[model samples]
Target: MADRILTEEEKAAQERRGAAGGAQRGGPPHMRLGQPTEKSQNFGPSARRLLGLMAPDKVLVWAAMAFALVSVALTALGPKILGRATDLIFSGLFSKQIPANVTQEQAVEGMRAQGETKLADMLAAMEHIRPGQGVDFTAVRNVLLLALALYAVSSLLSWTQARIIVRVVNTAVYRLRRDVQAKLGRLPLSYFDSQPRGELLSRVTNDIDNIAQSLQQTLSQLLTSALTVIAMLAMMFYVSPLLAIIALVTIPISIGITAFIGKRSQVKFVQQWKSTGEVNSIVEESFTGHELVKVFGRRDEVGARFQAVNEELRDATFGAQFISGLIMPMMMFVGNLNYVIIAVVGGLRVASGSMSIGDVQAFIQYSRQFTQPLTQVASMANLMQSGVASAERVFEVLDAPEQTPDPAHPETLVDPHGRVSFEDVSFSYTPDRPLIEHLNLCVEPGQTVAIVGPTGAGKTTLVNLIMRFYEVDGGRITLDGKDITDLTRDNLRSQIGMVLQDTWLFGGTIRDNIAYGRPDASEEDILEAARATYVDRFVHSLPEGYDTVLDSEAGNISAGEKQLLTIARAFISDPALLILDEATSSVDTRTELLVQQAMANLRQDRTSFVIAHRLSTIRDADLILVMEDGRIVEQGSHAELLERGGAFARLYAAQFAGALTEDAEAGQGAVPRGVPVH
Candidate 1:
């Protein structure tokens, strides 16, 4: 069975299992759903390319940086300004009361005569310029107002900065998603066949979403953290070089601890996402094939398998999150330790009068600011790693080679005779192993060609070649004396109609589906096609008749009805060539007979190639080819092939030995008795 993608319910269940908070490293929820693993990818290339994605928004980036600079500058200066306020309060409120007009000697004598000896002594030490008596409320108010203004302006600029950054990120990812979508159209069918649908979906949805989220969250933090660290360090140095140097010691220590913890987490991050994808794959498979699983009584086995993957996911997520989670707390510990050290040393300096109390306070604040960003930077490392990994995946799709080019000068067939000829055609699914070799065939207009073969005998592959789903490896296939390769694939395909064993009816009303092959078909044309294929019999039975909507899987319709719908679709197209591979396999004998009659009528003037394992279906075919492995072992009419007693005769006997005996008992000669030519 073709691998199907996860359904909405399964995907929703996976999401419910994600961490209540979010994925580690700011990746998608899928990343958080898997178990911890050991893998790492170098993000240098993706990172450079990510920056290239942002290259278009250079002006906005510069604007954001400018705003960040202003915000950081104002924020960094806050401590120093607060120190000034402290100095103003200290100088204004605590000075001894003495008149500026009175000399110290006179003040001292007056105080002594009033019997205030402490004041008299303080006055004796006072200089000619007397201390003020009242607080400097006006000066203090101005300083406070200026500090408040700086903060207000800083906040405004920061908001503006955030808006611009958001714009830049949104635009970058918009372009990225657009490129990925465009790349999808350019990619070949082989790419889709080689990759899982869910995996491709994840690349387009989950991975791209993760990249956008990582950018919005981490990019903002990254820019702000960088500025905060720089501003803090500068202020620390300006306050006291000794304290600044002392605080710098914590940088290497914090970084070493973070790097040690973060590196291990980063390695697990890639593994985490991969395991998550694996689990999702299992869920998708089980959900899509739940019916088969239940019918085969494999529910317990499938459940056990799901439980094992879930356990793996839980373990990996715990390991990655547990390791990465230690970053901030450990850095906080180092920061607190550094804070204590600075406080003790600065206290000594203050005691020695080398630094003021206010400077020491500001320095301590600066130390906290400095270490805080160091911690943040270490955390951003994880997010950056995952984002870059996601970018690499998206880029891989975008970078895939495009489909083979169409011919510059294409050939066309006019008044076509529906003649299909395969001349020395050769093809192999793999390059080293040759499958079909120098195969030759000729089909006349309005002839029914039957191809009967065992499993793995390249039945579908041969038909695929004629449809140009795959090109012939060695020789050319021609239609009406013109090489198919010389014609544009689109033009060649327009002339052929196909109905496969697996009926596909997309989500739409009954009429809409029948008209899918010929969008411009009128209602009358659709009704006639439906009647021809016996689709209208059941379609009219529905409550909504032709207006009834089909589900995505089209399960609302019976398998037989679905098959009839597809046949009707092919009939509506009314192409010159018809290819049917077990087209009536889904229906009962009665419906199959009806469909066969309909198909016979449809094939009246068109060349038809019928692929069948049932000998009854192709008994009256104009020409029958019995294939073994990849070569046709027998080719003849029904009576001729039976008379030869070759592979065709053997296969026919295997399917209807009793019928053949009955025919001979009835004196019917060598012709098969199960089915007769009409």
Candidate 2:
């Protein structure tokens, strides 16, 4: 077959598709960060759901709100209380102007009769005034002390409310992280197959942290700000309704500014997080495939990809912050305008004697209080929007459909013989494209079956069915005459051991990595498994021997050593069934022979399924199955299939064609090239 060349655009698209596929494992299409932001459609519902995370702590939240309310009420009442001192001082000054011989009422009436109506009214409105006293220093002192006490109490309540809110936020976020972790475990393999790892990780870590911060910073402040707005409005109206009306004119304008900027900024915040996920995906993939990238000299391409996604993140974050930032200054602008208007109107009322100097003073203070909270509310819109965006992303993971649960009454596997059979099984990763169909196979308890085929020929898929990593769309598989589906996945998997082409070892001792298959294994069992797999041969050369700790990536060990350790892991389990998918592919030819010998020993009396592309590795198998496009086209011993001269013959001939010519030139028997050498 000729290789079809791709157009430039097609190549770019393919790269993007590859990047998307590499984004971890596959997940929901909407959650994929390949195309960029997945904006939350309903802000109200998302915000409500985010708040609902704190439902378990609602009692604490309500207590905090109550404290904030009382705190704000006290704060709002402070100016009014202070206004009393002003009234007392001014009233005493007016009383001293009157004659000491006249009574307080008579002085006021005489002043009114002498065409001093405004002064008479001002003096009449003053309370607790002695006719000849210049000022009552004791009353003034008491008023000052009372105002200070109210402020001190309000500060204490504010601190208490803040502390409660922080605890509630921490608790709520803790639960959210726990729920997400549990949800990830319940998700099906297919869900992970298409998802990007970095993107999902961002949701789990970055998004959750952002949620906590948003709640901690804004929840209490929002509660206090809201209450302050209410309390201040009431105080303003009580002091003078006309001035209060003038102050209210800015409320609608502030709302308009917040609504407009908040709407645009929300979209940017969504983009910011999505771009962040994409950036994470790129970095993770680049790091994981660093050697391959260096070999291919794709460093420039990777850097460009990172730069592009990072630029998107930068733009998104900038846009969100810049737009949301407009709210504060804009609100302050509206507030200042309102403040100027209220000051002018309040002063006029005081001058006309319709309102006392202290009353007008309190009214102006109330006006300032009302506008300040509105400003805070406007500024908080950014944090709320960003947090809601992250919350919705997290909610998506929690809402993903879970894998089918294990049966309520799970069947237990008895002291089992590993006789496995697939009964006309059919399956596909997607509904439109069927990969495997009507496949039937059975391996006896002690048989070693080898599966060989080209890539994408369902060789690995067959064993996966036996392990129940995925369920068949049609028919069922069985072990020991019982349907595998009836058994819990853990129970079924417990009896099988798998060593794949890719090796995985965590940051732990070599002994720990080997014992991972059966943590309950004794020290002797671990050492025995290590010896059986040839892992002991190399461990003695290392500085720490079996105790040597592997890094997270296991970079300290060679690939062949890593593969050997994985094999020892399988050996320690001593499972009834064993699966080796090109398990020796990573080792050198010398190491491969040792591994094959080790495997041979481990396979004694075990039902082992070996998937190999290196034909030499499976030549001695008791049974060999030739698969193509999801069906077994041929099945027999290696020599039997080579003599048959069919698909297996063609594959064998193609692989060893050059070596056969060299053998013929060396004067060996001119037997058919497809024939297996004994």
Error of 1 at 395 (Å): 3.8
In candidate 1, list every pair of residues with a backbone clash: 34-313, 35-313, 35-316, 36-316
Task: Report the lDDT of model 1 for residue 449.
Answer: 89
Q: Which segments of model 2 are wrong by more than 4 Å? A: 1-16, 19-37, 93-120, 661-678
For every model shown, what is its TM-score relative to the native structure? 0.82, 0.92
List, residue by residue over 164-228, the lDDT tens digit for candidate 2.
Answer: 99999999999999999888877766555556678788889998999999999998888898899
Tens-digit per-residue lDDT, 1-678, candidate 1: 111222122233344543231221223332221222244445556677887898988999998999999999998998888767765565444344656566557766887899977655543533222355545667778878988989899889888998898999999999999999988865655555544455567778877898998899888778888999999999999999989999999988987997788767766666666556656666776788799989999899878877886787788677777788888788889989999999999877765547666678888888988888887877676677677766766777776777666789998865777999999999865576677899999999999989887766777667778877667889899999899988987788888888877788889899998998889999999999988888878877898999999999998888888888888888998888888888887779987887788788778899998988887788779999887767888888877887777777777767776766787898985655433322
**So what's the TM-score on candidate 1?**
0.82
lDDT for each of the candidates?
Answer: 0.76, 0.83
Number of the predicted model whose lDDT against the real structure is largest: 2
